[model samples]
Target: MSDSGPVLPWLVIRQDDNGNRYRVGRYATEDEAQKIADSLHARGRHEQLYVVERISQPAL
Candidate 1:
């Protein structure tokens, strides 16, 4: 979550009407992630939904 890290913690998630979820991809910035999600949602089925979320990097 820190700006100093090179990790991409922003996630683009897709969820279906059935409540099933899948990870679309990851991005370095929230805006980037949201844009990807929006693009997917625009072209995908109407019953599906796209969202952006920030995730913490796992401790190594």
Candidate 2:
């Protein structure tokens, strides 16, 4: 199989109080993505959650 070009494995995901998840952004490194997640979390809005994840495939 051919490899996908310019893949970003790191992802920042946002989840709302209703359990709906969204992709906030993508990064080249986990640290970069986590930094964004941390900043969002620091907003102190308990109704939402931010998380970082490493994935194998490109987003659709």
Best by TM-score: 1
| TM-score per candidate | 0.82, 0.79
Evaluate model 2: give its TM-score: 0.79
Worst lDDT 10-window in candidate 2: 1-10
Best model per lDDT: 1
Clashing pairs in 1: none
Quote the lDDT for 19 in model 2. 96
For model 2, the superposed segments whose C-alpha errors exceed 4 Å read 1-5, 58-60
Error in Å for residue 8 of model 1: 0.6
lDDT (10s digit) by residue, model 2, range 1-60: 236566688999999999999999989889999999999999848998999999887456
Q: Residue 14 of candidate 1: its Cα lDDT?
A: 91
Please estimate how well model 2 matches the true structure, expressed as its whole-model Cα lDDT: 0.89
